[model samples]
Target: MNLEELREYCLSLPHVTEDMPFGEEILVFRICNRIFVLTNLERIPVSVSLKCDPERAIELREQYPDKIVAGYHLNKKHWNTVSLEGLPPTLIKEMIQHSYDQVLAKVPKKETLKFI
Candidate 1:
């Protein structure tokens, strides 16, 4: 998917909001104000960094060594930067959802109910 497609997908998630806190060129998607997705707007092919389960993150990098890697400028153990140039769109959506769920899991139960 491209940058606009990625932005649309992230905004489609409940409680997700976009911001340019790092600057206009860096786009950030947050759930409950906690970032789950981030990307550089100026970059082509749309690489996105998403929060991920540690074990799954390593497995993904291993399985798609060229298309996926440890998150750039993010905690290597808990995030991944995925290149969208040739990866399956379904997989991209799943990774985005997983990142949303990871952050949602940390929300307080009462606050989380609003998203349910």
Candidate 2:
């Protein structure tokens, strides 16, 4: 997916909000003010940094060496930077969903209801 598609998909998730807290060029998608997805608006070919399961993160990087990598400036054990240009949209959406789920896992159950 491209930047627009990525933006729309992230927004489509429940309680997701778009922000530019890091500045105008970096787009962030958060649930309950906790970030799940982020991207650089100025980057070519579009890419995203996503929260991910540590083991799954390693598997993904191994499976797609060039397209998926350790999250830039993020905790390498729990995040990944994925290039959107060549990957399947379904996989991209899954990663976003996983990130959203990761955020939900950390939220209080009652507070998370706002998303449902």
Candidate 3:
């Protein structure tokens, strides 16, 4: 997906909000005010960082070495940076959903997730 397409997908998630806390070029998406996905707007072919299960993160990197890698400027064990240059859009969407679910599961409020 393209930048606008990805932005639309992210904002469609319940309780998600976008911010440029780092700068105008960096777009961060948060749920319950906790960041889950980060995108570099200035970069071509979009680069996004998403939280992931530690073991799953390693597996993904090993499986998609050219497209997925250790998170940029994030805890290497819990996050991943995905290059959307040629990866499947469905895979990217799943990545975003996993990140959202991982964060939502830790929020201590199941009722809040019902709205999503």
- Measured against the true structure, the TM-scores of the candidates, in listed sequence, are 0.93, 0.95, 0.91
Better of 1 and 2 by TM-score: 2
Cα lDDT of model 2 overall?
0.94
Q: What value does the lDDT take at residue 43 in candidate 3?
A: 89
Across 1-116, the per-residue lDDT of candidate 2 in tens digits comes to: 88889988999998888989999999999998899999999988788999999999999999999999999999999999999999999999999999999987999988877766
- Winner of 1 and 3 under TM-score: 1
- The weakest ten consecutive residues by lDDT in model 2 span 107-116
Model 1 lDDT per residue over 1-116, tens place:
88878888999998798899999999999998789999998888779999999999999999999999999988999999999999999999999999999998988988867755
Candidate 1 TM-score to native: 0.93
* Candidate 1 segments exceeding 4 Å error: 110-116
Candidate 3 — worst ten consecutive residues by lDDT sum? 107-116
> Model 1's lDDT to the true fold?
0.93
- Each model's number of backbone clashes? 0, 0, 0
TM-score for candidate 3, residues paired by index:
0.91
Residue 97 in model 2: shift from native, Å? Answer: 0.4
Tens-place lDDT per residue, model 3, 1-116, is: 88888899999998898999999999999998889999999988688999999999999999999999999999999999999878989999999999999988887676555544
Best by TM-score: 2
Candidate rank order under lDDT: 2, 1, 3
For residue 22, model 1's alpha carbon misses the true position, in angstroms, by 0.4
Error of 3 at 80 (Å): 0.3
